[model samples]
Target chain A: MIGWTRRNAGDQSNSEAVIQLTNVDYTYQAGSPFAATALHDINIRIRKGTLVGIAGGTGSGKSTLLQLLNGLLLPTGGAVKVLDHTLLPNMQKPRLNALRRRIGLSFQFPEQHLFEDTVEKDLMFGPMNFGSSRKEAQSKAVEALKSMGLDEALLKRHPLTLSGGQMRKVAIASVLAAGPEIVMLDEPTATLDSAARRELIALLARLCREEGRTILMVTHRIEELMEVADEWIVMHEGRAVFQGDADELADRSEELDHWGVAVPEQLRCWAEWTARLPQLAALPLPRTAEDMARRIEEAVHGFEKCESTNIASKEGSQQESAQELNDQADSSMDAPYRHEKEVSACVTS
Target chain B: MRDKLIIGRMIPTGSRVHGLDPRSKITAMLLFTAALILSNGWPQLAALTILSILVLTATKIPAKTYLRALRPLRWLMLFVFLFQLIAGAGNGTVNLAAADPLLWSGTWGPFTLTSAVLSSALLAVSRMALLIVFTAMLTFTTTPSMLSRGVEGMLKPLSRKGTGAERFSLMMRLALRFIPALLEEAQTILKAQAARGADYEEMKLKEKARLLLSLLVPVTVGAFRRAEELTTSLEARGYRIGAPRTAYRQLIWRSADTWFTLLFALLPVGALLMRLTV
Candidate 1:
């Protein structure tokens, strides 16, 4: 029953706050001479079932923020609320094992932590720690493995023997086996091939969408999560400078560089398109290349139609020429798959 | 854990001690150790302690930093003190009726206490404290590479060829450099495992052992991976074993370094002189 939260009809304000940090300041080795403030005055509220991408440069307190949420580290100042528990500066932490079970944190290069003799055992370690029976843990292990899009046969192999990608997946699956409501991964896609990274992100997005688990992921590269991240938290030098959806992120794309964050190509392309055609901003920001391309084509077609109408009114004799130009525009329409290259060109231009 | 380790760390105050040639510092450390071992009486101990304090003051680092370095060894120091005290008190082989008479003798409960036993114990504890503080000073003043280079320089005469000394010094340098890196990696792994609910502090002894067992593979693998990367980098930079390499920053033995070594040489000589007079 620990870490369990039941919905109350009367309470609505903080009900959606799966993880909330209010004026949270974290200093490593606080009170010691070597004390360093890793995070400063950070305030972020992540709602339930939302896939939040936490992006920051190196040492921007992204990893520290994840640790704070899980009670691995108590803040030197302010409070960190994850699920039903609240962690204050010097409070006797609520049963951390219980809190950790509810909020699974997978650190950067998590594959390096995989140490069990076999992959199944490694996956079971988390569930067993949370008081699950051996059989229950085994079943959970299989479920977790399957959820990560890994083969069931891989459960019997030694974790060290697995391919790097497989090992990374198994390592992530171990945390998933604990059945945490809030799964926080720190740079899960790092050191992974592009295809593998995409697959992993898709799987994580599915976990958030299908299971309604709040997924807080930390990444230096925001491009990987641009499509799926329901919310984006941009950390700038230990501060949560921005926390909003894709559109809001698009609006503030200019500031990403000042924050030491590389503005994703998608965001840059969107900014360019929005700049050229101001009315395109009215619609929801396209999350995928195909969607963006389609939107762009539609906008271009609308512009052409307006141009042709104007020409027909002013110069009725050149109506055929306008029709010919419209046909040419239709033929010149590039396929959606080529949008990424075209967008990059547009951004560069 | 990383913060606890003061050895292999250099806190530069830009003082004379920091500027002293590492070779002279290493020589001074050996001389101090010899003096510390030779000193048996109160006067000798007091002299050494004062000398150490003076040298420590010259370093310009906070006194508390050295005390913090000693923090981890508190229990060991206590254990040594008690062991020496009990052994000295219980020794029946001591000729108490001879030259030195007991300053005081008493009994409380079942255990006997004597001034001779107490003094000897205090001496042993003081020696240990001084030794630790002095060793810490050498490390604190000299960077790991400089220490290794000084060691290599000293070992040059003993080697049949330069290769043996060069290889050993390189090994020393690598170890000094990597100890902190390895500790940091271990800490990270420990934190990662803790996040998975294997909180080492909360775990029982058996569970703790099991968790440590689990950590061994990853840490070892990480070390090997790092070693491989390091070798590749070294080779990439055209470094070769036993190759005649010139120092980028050559060790300059100033008149100050000679004077520094000579000052340390006096400690053991003074201790020996005092012993002869007694």
Candidate 2:
């Protein structure tokens, strides 16, 4: 076990862990009638400036883990250290307030928290509470709204008047106004249309890439985060079952699917194709459509050499088999070509 | 139908009353209730009534909305008025002497209205109305969470005695939030029962009582399940009962709160002096 731990610790010098859960165990009130253990002996570390995706089924304790990051819930049996604050079962009031200011949490279906009359006041609530002046808070609200790709005209409008997608953005902008170093969201894209979901993911990606903020989001849809997330954490029945880089996750796609999380269909198809062509399997698995296209081009070139070898070895029977293999390749190429063209259009236009 | 409840509806006006620290509002409410109790005559009651109405108007919520809020109490108000009119007692009546020319007209019954009973009933109804309107004003402007926090803040000075005030308020807020959701669930259960040969509206009184009792079992079981899930979610978010934490929305006392307090305080004292002089 020690050797495996040492072997796994490779090239972690550039990144620093922002949240560390050390042997954390939590059980609901023990003497109560409905008492049950929610999490047990959990240890995980989330690094700074990375988008970490946590995937789990219902009642798998994914929600329980997110609460521990901001000291919203305490561990019953162990310790949780978030940044500079160490949270024990008994925490002082002052320390808890300090911890909350450093971490911004957006609860599930966050639009419920929009209780202010106008978008500006709702966004300003957090910053003002944390001791920002009126002017500074208003500026932060504007900045946060802009980050969500919302218009300045929305500031005076009631939050309830906005459309569903806009309401979700304003809810997020309220959290951003607090200016926390780390932002955690619970199912941010749940119930959104595909276009809105894509825009939200892109916005989160920018926060991590451009603003240098650490983001930890819980998502049942693992495929949604495939292109943007740098790290993957899989939870099952209150345990951190797997934690590693995105590439490491690609190899464990089958295990993930069995755990009730759907891996992207594109990745699965590419994996199956690579399995039949052993020479192509040597290359790294691609995370996006463009990456898949480049890999396929290389694979087709490799296939030409194999075809030539087969023709040289068996000149008599090569024509019929070669034609059939070519036909299969042609069909596969056609679908991917159209997909690439659509993606490029989206990117450019 | 469930959405019509005035308890958790937060009107997002940024008026001074809306922004005043919840602790101040709670204190002011107690003080206002005490003054209403001390008020005796028309002069004092009129002052208190006018003050409440002015505050209500200043909230800038629609007049129609305020009247609509009173709709729930309409039946109860009529009951009180009818009870007062019929059941009231008065002084003894005097019969006229027909032979004496100097004798005037006689009072036939003791049922005639008198200052004592009439004044008491009128004052009681006015006090009740004032209390409801003022309390509604507080809830109308503030979120349920803020109200709970305000209650917690007011109780903070005594928290050393293990009251768990903050946790209790948090529970109240959660309960208020889930009331509508629970009512919807109960309605669905009622509909399901009706679909399966249980006609609640057509049933006799005894049968209706039995059917309602049967509905309680499922509703209670559903409520417990929800409470369990809510507890887990809250606990996971680092909520500790009895642990002190800084408020996200701090209540600060402004000049308006102080001025409002002074104005209410002077009314009862001035009324007492006026009654003594008269």
Worst 10 residues of 2 chain A by lDDT: A1-10
Highest TM-score: give the candidate number: 1
What candidate 2 gets wrong by more than 4 Å, as runs, is A1-13, A92-94, A309-349, B1-278
For candidate 2, what is the lDDT?
0.70
- What DockQ results do all the predictions give, each relative to the true complex? 0.73, 0.02
List model 2 lDDT by residue over B1-278, tens digit each: 34344544667667766776676677778878877766655667788878887887778776656665666777777676556655553321111112113322234386554444445455566667777778888788888887888787777687768867776787788887788778856654553333222335546698687667546755775678789999999889998876667776667778877777777677667766765675
| TM-score computed on alpha carbons, candidate 1 | 0.90
**Model 1 ranges off by over 4 Å:** A1-15, A92-94, A310-349, B89-101, B108-110
Which residue pairs show backbone clashes in model 2? A72-B237, A72-B238, A72-B239, A73-B237, A73-B238, B21-B251
Which tens-of-lDDT digit does each residue in A47-153 have in candidate 1?
88778899988889999999898888889999888888899998875568988999898988999998888999999999998889999999999999999999999
* TM (chain A), candidate 1: 0.85
- Cα shift from native, residue B239, model 1 (Å): 1.6
Q: Write the per-residue lDDT of candidate 1 for residues B14-56, one digit (tens) a residue.
A: 8999998999999999999999888777788898889899999
